[model samples]
Target: MENHFMKRSFLTLPLVIALTTSAAISQSLPPDDHQNVASLQSAADQGNSDAQLKLGIMYFNGQEVPQNEAKAAEWFQKSADQGDENAQKALKALFR
Candidate 1:
């Protein structure tokens, strides 16, 4: 009975190790900047209010990107269309 139990344990040991090692390897991969940018760009393109607001702020502050008031206003307008108070405030600030 003990030998039988040991055989079963040995059989599962490799599988358990494989699963853990694969998970570790997958977790170790570096974050993809392009993937992040693509996700943000897609959300912005789809007129997501939050994404638009973030894009507007990025433009306004040149954070990890370029600064352009016109672009900022454009994105803020999109977000404002969704009734975002912050975007509305930004738009007013930019235009006025």
Candidate 2:
């Protein structure tokens, strides 16, 4: 059981780091950089899995957006539905 959890953590750590970094970068963007942020949101809206995951991370951490677990779950679910393993794992972690 412990090993299973560890493996799950190991697999998810990278994804978490990547997503968090992406969200952080977005948050740090200047107001004039709304184009990039808009582009990212547009990608997520168009069903880009990584973009969805990044938005999920952003919502989860209150980065560019407010912290909203429900919104985070929604974005994570969208990414997971697209067969993103990292998003699937992220959703699981969010639920737990």
Output the number of the TM-score-best candidate. Answer: 2
Q: TM-scores across all candidates?
A: 0.61, 0.65
Residue 73 lDDT (model 1):
81
Report model 1's TM-score to 2 decimal places. Answer: 0.61
Q: What value does the lDDT take at residue 67 in candidate 2?
A: 89
Q: How close to the true structure is residue 72 of candidate 2, measured as C-alpha lDDT? A: 86
- RMSD to truth, every model: 20.1, 4.6
- What's model 2's lDDT at 94? 64
Worst 10 residues of 2 by lDDT: 14-23
For model 2, what is the C-alpha lDDT against the true structure?
Answer: 0.80
Among the numbered candidates, top lDDT falls to 2
Candidate 1 structure quality by residue, lDDT tens digits, 1-96: 999778777665543453345335535778662235467769989988878877776676565568787887898899999998877766765553
Q: Which lDDT values do the candidates have, in the order given?
A: 0.68, 0.80
* Candidate 1 Cα errors over 4 Å, as ranges: 1-35
